[model samples]
Target: MIQPHQHADQACSECTQRLGLIESGLRGVTPVRFNAAGWYRGELRREILRLRLNQDVSVLKAITFALQRTLPAKALLVPIPSWKTQKRANPLPALICRSLGRTTKTLLKRCRPTVGQHHLSRRQRLVNMKSAFAIHPDQQSWCVSATPTWIVDDILTSGATAQEALHTLKRAGLEVRGLICLGRTP
Candidate 1:
């Protein structure tokens, strides 16, 4: 079931295991882990693009289902960006947002990166992620009118990351509707 506040108490292992399912090409040499913040971990060096191509579709389909039944149109998809090279290594969130955006007929893009929340406390998670993401400048006009906006990610651990994304988008003047992910820790 979906949680109203988009709590991040769920485990990250569920998404990690699913990412490990495909075994060919980039998946064969990478290591995957359940991050403390409830997100899946993986080497982003070369696998980031491949993961987006392979496993991201299924995850996107799932997000589409969740949003279609809950949110209204004009809900733009904003993915929280990772730190620097991290984007090239494990761009899973971006991948899922792109796919789901097409399926849902919404806009998707990465605005900025916030500090990593892996080992931080709940409060630290919030502080570290504050102002961490923004709607792409090109899409700024789309979000200016208080439309519903959703932050998409792979896992929801601690929720610090999504919370920061929500804050950033909202600060930029978008009505953050909610958070969506592939799995929750429960």
Candidate 2:
């Protein structure tokens, strides 16, 4: 069973509430804004273990529950890559995707470096993140047969990042099933 302390003792109200929503019906999924709304505040980060705990467990549980009932077929969990790997330690999307994956670890990779999407304007964000992601050539064997994937992320703002990831995966002949995020700005 999943343990709460496995992540951290602190759980934000947003995380709790989100878990509830995802548990109910899998709709009303929103992205958690770490920058603008300061959702990624140091305290929240520490509490949520800097998103290391599968802080979005609620979200993953929802996806798992749905997939178990609807699409029993195997699925791939692909995450948008982080530009800098040394700092953050681990990519939250990739981590979350691994938590949800049934048959594999993760297939998405960032082949190119891009600037932070937060500082850029909508247009800039799109341009900056373009071609930022690619399926690891080494993992082609796994993805070649895996149809329909879930592009996982911590949040969904303009959807540019996830869209770019989808575009790259599709070019590699992988079918994207849907996009899953912890929260979204509605």
- The most accurate candidate by lDDT is 2
Instruction: Report the lDDT tens digits of candidate 2 across residue range 127-182.
Output: 88778877776787765665556666666667678778878777877877656554
Q: What is the lDDT of candidate 2?
A: 0.54
Clash pairs, candidate 2, are 30-183, 30-184, 31-183, 31-184, 149-177
How well is each residue in 165-184 modelled by candidate 1, as lDDT tens digits?
Answer: 66666677776766755433
Give the 10-residue window scoring lowest on summed lDDT in candidate 2: 29-38
Which prediction has the highest TM-score against the true structure?
2
The CA lDDT of each predicted structure is 0.49, 0.54
**Clashing residue pairs for model 1:** 10-185, 11-185, 37-157, 38-157, 44-89, 44-90, 45-89
